[model samples]
Target: MTPISSLANPTIKHAAALLTQHRIRKKSGQTVLEGVHLIEAAIKQNFTIKQIIIGQSALSHPEVAGLIEQIAQSIILATDAVYKQIRSLGTGVDIMAIVEIPTPALGVITSDCLILDGLQDLGNIGTLLRTASAVGISTIISTTGTAHLWSPKCLRAGMGAHFSLAIFEQVDYEAILQKVKIPLYATSSHTDKVIYQHNLTQPIAWVLGHEGQGVSEIFLRTATAIALPQPNGQESLNVGVAGSVCFYEMLRQRQFAQH
Candidate 1:
């Protein structure tokens, strides 16, 4: 295909708009993946890549070339000027792919999962996702107040974890509480019960709260409270760190049981 150099090109404009506008993404159920690694990860996970765009400068990169050969859709070559608008500066991003966001078939709400409750920081959301996947938590649910699960910032910070796991975003907190099969555990700075004392082996749904407000009172009222002991006198841990600690503890407990 001829190299697309015009900013007015329809495909080019659509891709740029998708990167910046949440409404467009939500309406179309699509998202952008920047860089070769994410594209490769999506392909490995069998995500439907609608199209792949490669900068003229990166056309010869083996990674880009390999992606072109593997993807069975449009692979557009673009001038650096046009490509520059598509990738964030300093990311060394020479390729980007437009992909359809898969609707998670939440067949059953299983325990041993993490539910993000009103978490606002996109980076923290992404980090929690990566941590959840690391601990073998396959299903994640993000309530209405949480950041967009497929937002570019979250997608980038997730480092390909998004494609490997099942995520249900914009979920109703109350709806889940009504239907969840296992205990819902929420962390608190003031709780008397420490996480270590909790039975981690039993399938449980971990409810991570907002960074500033902690979990919503709705969750606090319905969920069991677990505390993280901070000997350093820190007022609180970052939500991402606190959530990871809980996940690792759960992993440790489950591993010990297998032994």
Candidate 2:
């Protein structure tokens, strides 16, 4: 029942800065989740919740109602107008939470892996992680060049995927080298080895590279490059789509061989 109406409120200003500026989030060691789905996902994933800012209007929603009754975290009550003032920049999301995500380590997360070399699009990277987890790829290690997995855009695009798996962001190739012992494969348009030609039954790291630059020389130095057969003139598979194909293919092989 606490009405926070002042933009000058320290917590409100901090949240506004977090939503508007990336540096502010990193500086403060926190992130903002605007939609109820995203906030609940963070909660399910056990991310540290520092502030739960709810719109007075949102109290009627079932998700918000459930969260208020079950969660012991701090809560901030704001008028609907005040809530909208700090809502995410163009998203129309009415609820928001500030949660702390762990700074990721630079190594192999699990046996089946998805290694992102330099993907920049937060949405693409996030969806890939979501798809990866769905196919039972348990761990993902992203190079420093990719979008931050904990960023709001990536988190939303992930659609709660992080709740079920280990994600390491801001990692380096040297770290990957030490962690992944099984074969590492990279996705490309010009590879000589088609996906079916390779045996994916073995544990492998499917490395999808930069958006336009493709995989790196450093990764290429060690990875066996892989490509989807394109009989038509399709230029390249979108990285997220490409990774999805690779993950399911790996699943198909593993599941079939297991039987």
Candidate 3:
């Protein structure tokens, strides 16, 4: 078992490229999943694992050792110096993996879904995806202007939601509109009809817009205008928070109806 101690190693450099350059990741059809939790999630989902790199410090952990032995992929030990260079963003990440990004066809979406319209902030996009996954919305569609759905920053923020979700990116909402038969609700700061007033149990699509521009007019034309009550007079809420509130409300409504 050769340890990857050299900074110039192609594997290390390639992982670095995936983190810094979105085009490289997309072109190669590979993305880096950092941390033990994310790596485990990807494995649990049975996503294709190309390689697993474990830091020297990470090897002592029982779970890390178990994964290295159980996973039938190329496993390399990384020295602290090398690990620091390729480790995923954030604290306590002593393990990382290079996994093939699954390119599943756009098949029928059966569950309630979320539409991200022109969202640019990676953190917001990730948070919304995480929220959507937590609340049982399995399909998420992102329009052209949105952040790269699989970018490392977004992936980190999403935690493991990406594994559970059927995320379609660079989509045209109008084309989606033609295929989806459910009601599409667009969030509006100006709308009088608050979200609480509506029955959200039925399968529907909630369109969350960009931080600044809001939802595009074209999408709005086909969507029901809905607002969240902002009694504190704050003119607006962060797109992530707004989307989460709507998702939870939908859950609450459906759960109550079930009882």
Cα shift from native, residue 168, model 2 (Å): 1.5
**How does candidate 2 fare on TM-score?**
0.92
Residue 21, candidate 3: Cα error in Å is 0.7
lDDT of 1: 0.86
lDDT of 3 by residue, 1-259 (tens): 6678997888888888888898898899898988878888888888888988888877888888878876998888889778987666655858888988766655556568898988999999999999999988988888887888888788889998999988887877666776666888889976799999998888988899989989989888988889999888998999999999999999899886545
Clashes of 2: 0
Span of ten consecutive residues with least summed lDDT in model 3: 102-111
The top-ranked prediction according to lDDT is 1
lDDT per residue for candidate 1 within 51-139, as digits (tens), equals: 88888989988878888889889888899888997676354848999999878645557667788998999999999989998888888
Off by over 4 Å in 3: 88-91, 108-110, 257-259
Ranking under TM-score, best-scoring first?
A: 1, 3, 2
Per-candidate TM equals 0.95, 0.92, 0.94
Clashing pairs in 1: none
Local distance difference test values of all predictions, in order:
0.86, 0.81, 0.85
Best by TM-score: 1
